[model samples]
Target: MQYLHALETAIIYIEAHLDEDIGLEDVARETGYSYYHMTRLFKSAVGETVGSYINKRRLSNAAKELLYTENRIIDIAIYNGYESSEAFSRAFKDIYRISPLEYRKNKHDFFIGSKKGLNIDMLKHITNSITLEPTIANFKETKIVGIRGEVALKGNGLSCLWEQFHRIYAAIPHTVPNRRDFCVCETNQTTYKKNGDAIYSEMIGTEVDSFEEMPDFVVNKTVKPGKYAVFTHMGSLANLEKTYDYIWGTWSLSTKEELDNREDFELYTEQFYSMDNPDNRIKIYIPVC
Candidate 1:
């Protein structure tokens, strides 16, 4: 969404309210965008939801108090908006994986998630690389067989997995001739590292006509029929992150379409032969409601 004005206003509003309880409606009122629009713009541009960002800010502050000052943990908890020390400890453990008492005793110097303030450079990098509007189309059900493993959101270590997959792909019986191979990612919404890195279960494989004669090491999957927003990722795979930021962070925000909870995948065809070629391109399918 090119609503840069509204997005800018939102960052200002959020920074001002970091010390207190912040809400989407409050930010919307101050920024002049509707609740729905403000929510989308803030998350898309900033890469996080308003509530989660606010929580991180407060927790970061509370952590400082635990390390430097001799303030009581209960007092620090209340200052950060927790009603009780137990509640605060629970939240603290969820992020830091340590109790407040243990954290204070150890006196660990720490930093919460780094996403804060408006990233002007990152936002400006979304050049005319990808299509502004995605092609909305219905996808047919396809059967897949591949090796699966957990991969980090950043620096997706999928090359080795894909290489191993190729060894088995040719031997699989009754393979689809014209269909494109898929790199499927199943994201975990509730789990994240302390530094905010996401871990997703990814599978890289090609379409198969039947489950019979499938290798024991590979698991089979069926992508259900649904509508998706298909965007083209132009250039080498190195810049796919920028294209995705624009798709999930910008285009999806500006559009009135809603996304559904379904498997999203990358389509690999002959264009992918040159993995690092500047002219290479691929289509990414995101399930939408």
Candidate 2:
């Protein structure tokens, strides 16, 4: 938990220096943590080393700059903390799979007035209080229309998934539940990326009983059944992410029951009518053995 506080402080430093040179020592100093401990904490809480995380982020931002600004590639590279154009190009290609010149030519990963940026500001102050209860349950196999994509803990991965859900749902006609949305994290065992990345968050809606054709989206064939460690998260969806860290980072470390090898899910039992209400709760079901 203290490490979590340190992480929050480190993220604030990262956000403050996104456009400047930010090294591990600087982050450690700013966060009041030793460099070794800071690296350990960041890796434990966020999955990647601090250097790798900062490099990837700078490269991601550089990609956006390539698309948004007509600034020279060298300038963009230097602005994002890269030593030289060659170094920046190598790093950019590693993350985005394209060079700055080609990226601009294709107009890829850019938009007009798109503040499509990721902020690590909230990582440090994540409110994480969760109670996990063990129970055995059976869930009826349900079919849903949803968009599926790999998501990272960093960036607007969850927000983008919801955006896709709305876009796909707008094209379909059904009596979908509006307030209680279903977000199922696909099993990490079968589909997780090599870096122990977070599972995909699918924005889903139950298929109408009489819908003649399934929409362009794939039918998510998943069954929610088994023993689980259920945790209820209350408050805004934006803040629900910290709840996940608690489940994975804190609860799992302190619990007797091991996390089950089944798909975990979030049930939005109630909508956030007001952002200030403390009684609103969302249930998180983690399969446990």
Deviation in Å, model 2, residue 159 alpha carbon: 13
Residue 262 shift from truth in candidate 1, angstroms:
0.9
Per-residue lDDT of model 1, residues 1-289, tens digit only = 5676666676677777776777888988988889988888767555557786667667767877887789999999998888899999988886666898998898654322222244444444443346657899999999987778776657656666777777877666777877578888776332445444556688887888898977678888887789999988877776776676656544554356777778788998887765577777789998899
Off by over 4 Å in 2: 1-5, 18-21, 110-121, 124-204, 208-235, 238-289
Can you give the lDDT of residue 217 in candidate 1?
81
Q: List the candidates' TM-scores in order.
A: 0.59, 0.50
Q: How well does candidate 2 score on lDDT at residue 228?
A: 68
Write one digit per residue (lDDT tens) for candidate 2, span 40-60: 887766555677667766776
